[model samples]
Target: MHQVIASPQGDKFIIARPGTRKGMQIPRAMHHELSSAVANGRDVPGWLVNAGREAWGLELSGQPARGNVLVRPVTPLNYSRATWEINKGCNFNCEHCYLAERAFEGLPRDEKDRLLSMLRDAGVLWLQFTGGEPTIDRDFPHSYRQAFILGMLVEILTNGSRLHRPEIIELLSAMPPHKVTVSLYGASPESFDSLTRKPGAFKLLTKGLKAAKEANVPLELALIVTKHNAHEVQAMREIADEYATTYTEYANISPTYDGNPQPLAAQAPGFLDKSSVFKGCPAGHTFFHVDPHGFATMCKVGRENPIGLMTEGLDGLLRLPAIADAQMLRSGGCSGCQLSATCRVCRPLAKAYQEAKAPLNTYCQHDNGDETA
Candidate 1:
């Protein structure tokens, strides 16, 4: 079975399995015990077993657990990759956006520079610049340039509407990101604009993509499958094929960051049918998201508990108790559910449903109305 174990000191976690050569990094505080147990490949310590149960919902039989525990483990002292949302303000109001019309003031130029410097100091090797729209941020080029100069591989996630601007193309052509992901909403302008509620957005996105292609920036196309544009998914795929860019698709539409299910209506019918069993999330582990306000959370799906970057710094914030606490799964009837084999629902969304008894139809693979679970 595929599984992972939490760090003994409670900062990082690792995927532990038999026949694998990786395990948790020896915590300085519990070096002897952890090191011995990990080396023997005999048994996991009681605290680690209990932490696995509590933090990750791991069902450990009363036996000596042995195997490669840490698969691509993260060093508690630093993270090599990060997803930074430079600005929360977005021009489009896509119906299925996880962020509910995100709007926020951006960090000043000096503050952005400081954050960029801190990221480089923390040993970030790849920085993904994202936003409501990253290119829309006036301070983006400065930060992107700085990250590139620091020798970090930079990437951008945008809707491709702003790439058509001459200045935008010039900046990108000068120092292209490692990759540019343009989310395609619809195959046609009418369908795309109807879904985005922004007239001429599809045209702008196409023009921007053409410009980016001419500039020779590595590009990718992602399709957001929704009820409004589900029919256009294949057409969008064909468009991406024509562009010779990497193509991907996501049918699931999650609740907003605020736990509001307003965008749930746009979810395509039978989207959950394709989901497989719940494995685990990488939150508080190898990956984390930093919002516009410098608050770090596991991911953008749920922003329930956040650590302030200014106060804690990336290392300190990630090590904070809240980061691990957020990973803890509420029982909420999922522990012994019969559908665990094909259940794709995650703990964060389940927690939201548990607290409010809200119905999240998007994750209901079996179509039952029991919201308490």
Candidate 2:
């Protein structure tokens, strides 16, 4: 049996293992369903624990789950605004690399199709086509085109180095994503190459950003905050400040398990808070991540292959039992904490926190399962 904790504010249900983490972890639908059932005098004999069990459907280790490992699934809202890392590997090297592992490599075509279908079905509103460099994918054109054709908004996040390549530019020029996200590593050659490490990467990135502007396509800029360029945030913004589609992303340097950029920093402590309230990291529901190998996951972090191959189209993915279950698990990061307003949780870090069975690193500010407040 599980312990069900309800929020005093209203119908928010916090279902978790007796020893698991705390805070709101119930899906909005389930909470409403249960609340309505109670209000209507329906003989709902089962409590949230029952619903929790129904969703996970996993035979527990028989040992009680540690309270740190809470379960809060995704809801309709999260899936709608999910950020997808369609591609993993990158062309440029950043000092604070997060997605530099082997898994970042492109997935097989069939697998790619399945992942896209799932995202479409799950009602993912914005699809961010990213990678070591999303442009590196030989079939990126097809992938970008497919998302456009499906009515799912799409964006391509890249270093912009290859944007000038004839074939690459021709394709990007012809069919641009809803928005093109590029990193302004530096304002000049020194600052740029210092972070990217590549000799001419900084110039290429600038040229690419300009190219996107000239193409009349939308643009978004992502930066990894670090000692190298924290002071230059304002300067960097000046260059593409208008295109900062992301509300404001400032991530501390956290190294990827592998393939990270040079001059990596120690994982910092503290959680990047979010203003948005979510049942969980909207992986399976609000968003789906497809790796280069064709495997799909609810969250982009970790190698945990929750749902298998994408057998059906977008609709099919939405109906996936495991994905649904995961989405409902809980938002392990942004509930009831002081950081709730600005705390931006990282899925990969959250998953790593869960997998490593360690404390939240101060660098990424993840929960190490040990909470002070």
Candidate 3:
């Protein structure tokens, strides 16, 4: 089990325990004292208890409190789960991929090992291994095994092209990723291969799904809605249901992380007019995205401003003023706009702000027909 302590001043600490990851935030002055007590297994001082009670209604005791020494049901820094794009290169070039073609360039093996060590030490509880395609990386096995051995819940996001191979399934069954999610492009070979631009990829994907089911790998399926496959979304869901796997759908198509607009034109109908705004986005505050070159950003699409993971380390990167002050980026015109209620794009997903001072045309649609500046 892993325990995390987040200070009100934006510092995070990971403490080991039996089970459950606990998080708390206190003032900077009290952080050192509380962390010292946690590390030494000593009772929290009187001052610390008073501060905890006033600030966050924290309950603490020398004896076990509901199986944990310190009890904090929540914290501001919810930095437990993270998505690491180990490699950017994918075997197939899907038409609607958010990543550009250059995304296939991956970091050197040694750099990958170093980053894994940093994440483990930082108390990352769940690691989602994503990429242009993670299986395409040769060093993926080594990195996956390292995280698994560290007691971290490992997840893999793949297209399921290589999963049919006996050796691939064997490795998955042996170590066993916590979750294996495969992206479904289309229901049939024609629709699937047309989108992936890879001949016979649909057959390979289905074969991999079958192999995964036979090998007892925990499986899930997701449908990515594109103009090419919008009509077949229901058929794809039925296929997933037949496999007895969890299914989900996402209709929104994003511009490339590197600011390419090529895929923007391929978005399905109602993709843009479907404006919805999630009140709070946890990207920089609680979650972060790491690119192939060890660059850590608030989110995958917000790569314009990045913190170098290799040079600064996780702790240092998280403490930066830029990351700590994470909040939704809204325009003056958007404040009074009626469409704000249904705007689905978050700050990081708004490439307009990250690139040039422009409003996201896709997210500016208003049912009331009010013009936004």
Prediction-by-prediction clash tally: 2, 51, 9
Model 1 CA lDDT for position 20? 21
Candidate 3: regions farther than 4 A off? 1-78, 271-276, 324-327, 332-338, 352-365
TM-score of 3: 0.74
Error of 2 at 350 (Å): 3.9
TM-score against truth, every candidate = 0.74, 0.59, 0.74
TM-score ranking, best first: 3, 1, 2
Candidate 1 TM-score to native: 0.74
Worst 10-residue lDDT window for candidate 3 reads: 1-10
Q: lDDT tens digits, residues 116-189, model 2?
A: 66555454546777676778777787777666544455667777787666766666555445567676664667
> Over 4 Å off in model 1, which ranges?
1-76, 318-322, 333-336, 352-361, 366-373
List the candidates ranked by lDDT, beginning with the highest. Answer: 1, 3, 2
Candidate 2 runs further than 4 Å off: 1-87, 103-125, 242-247, 255-280, 310-348, 351-373
Candidate 3 root-mean-square deviation in Å: 8.1
Cα-based lDDT at residue 53, candidate 1? 71
RMSD of each: 12.7, 16.2, 8.1
